[model samples]
Target chain A: EAGVTQFPSHSVIEKGQTVTLRCDPISGHDNLYWYRRVMGKEIKFLLHFVKESKQDESGMPNNRFLAERTGGTYSTLKVQPAELEDSGVYFCASSPIDTYGYTFGSGTRLTVV
Target chain B: GIQVEQSPPDLILQEGANSTLRCNFSDSVNNLQWFHQNPWGQLINLFYIPSGTKQNGRLSATTVATERYSLLYISSSQTTDSGVYFCAVNFNKFYFGSGTKLNVKP
Candidate 1:
């Protein structure tokens, strides 16, 4: 089976620009999550999705960030008016309900200048 | 939210040497996993050990859920082992430690 896949391994955008990151989870996986690691910081969870519905989103940093999972398959994270602080690596992971380990993607390195 | 702490923020080892990394959490966790981020920045899952001990070749991990700690052992270290090892604990959300940066020199 293919692992979780993320698009645009690297992205460069200007402050106040909008950027969208996409993730395609493994087949038949019900649980998908988003996380990010800023420079010199530990990775932090952003949100989670179970199928088409969001399971948890308390970790979302602000209103400028939005996530959606359509048709219970793939997910997209959009950052509106991106800030310089948003420069970091964004990772997506997927796991089956019965599995303990999650398969992670290569991550998207976002650079907002 | 629970706090995760990794000891010895950095470590250096010679090829073929062995090292042990530790992770401690402030609260109990139902899920704990170890991941290695390579130089090219890929998060590779090493182990999903919430409790007990598990071994895979030269790598082994033990998680003492009751004690709220986990240990990752890397034996016969290679240059490829040079990267960041992160321990993440899952409760309502996943909490990650700052990571232990390992450098293995040949």
Candidate 2:
């Protein structure tokens, strides 16, 4: 089976610009999540989706960031008016079952200048 | 959010050496995992060990839930093992430690 795949492996945008990163989870997976690592920081959770329903979004950084899982099949994270601090690697992962080890996508490197 | 810490922030070892990386979490967790981020920044799952011990080839990991600590052991280290190792856990949310950078000289 194909693993989790993320589009636009790398993106460069000017500050205040909008960027959307997409992720397609493994077939039949119900748990999808987004995580990111800012420079000089550990990777942190962004949000989670369970079969198209957002299970939790407490980790979302701010109002400028939006995450959506349409049809519970794929996910997109949009950052509007992104700041320099938003430049980092965004990782997407999914698990076939509840509370299982996640299979992660390669990741998207975002650079906001 | 729970706190995660990895000891000996940086380590350098010669080939054929064995090393133990430690991770300490502030609270109990429902999940714990170890991952290796290569030079290219790809996170590769090393082990999914919440409790007890598991071994795969020269890589082994042990998580002591009661003590809220986990240890990842690398045996017969090679240059290919050089990278950043992160220990992450989740209670209601996921948390990752700063990570330990290991450089194995050939």
Candidate 3:
């Protein structure tokens, strides 16, 4: 089975621009999560999706960020008007509801200059 | 929110040596996991021991849930083991420790 997959392994955009990161979780796994590591710091949770519903999104930074998991298959995180502080390696992980082990992707390194 | 702290913060060891890393959490958790982030920035799952002990090859982990602490042991360390080890705990949302950066010289 394929692991969690993230697109555009690297992305650089000007501040105030918009960037969207996509994640394709392992097949049949309903639990998907988004996390970020800023400037080699500790990784922080962004949100979690259970199938097509947002289970928990308390970690989302601000109103500029939006996340959606459609049809319970894949997820998308959009950072509108990206800020310089938003640059970091965004990781996506998935797990089976019955199990707690998470399989993470290589991560999308976003750079907002 | 929960607090997680990893010991040493950094460690340097010679090849074929053994070492221990520790993670302490502030609260009880429903899930505990260990991950190794390699140089390429891939988080590889090492163990998922919310409690009890489990071992895989040269790596082993023990999580004493009641004490809110966990330990990761690496035997016969290799250069490939040089990376950042992260301990994450989940209650409603996952929280990660600062990570222990390990450098195993060959």
Worst 10 residues of 1 chain A by lDDT: A95-104
- Please state the error at residue A10 of candidate 3 in Å: 1.6
The sequence of per-residue lDDT tens digits that candidate 1 reaches over residues B20-65 is 9999999988799999998877888999999999999999999999
DockQ-derived CAPRI band for the predicted complex in model 2: medium
Highest DockQ: give the candidate number. 3
TM-score per candidate, chains pooled: 0.95, 0.95, 0.95
Query: Where does model 2 exceed 4 Å of error?
Result: none
Which regions of candidate 3 fall more than 4 Å away from where they truly are? none
Pairs clashing in candidate 1? none
Tens-digit per-residue lDDT, B1-106, candidate 3: 8999999799999999999999999999999999999997888899989999999999999999999999999999999999999999988778999999999999
How many clashing pairs per prediction, in order?
0, 0, 0
> How much is A20 displaced in model 1, in angstroms?
0.9
The model with the greatest lDDT is: 3
TM-score of chain B of 1: 0.98
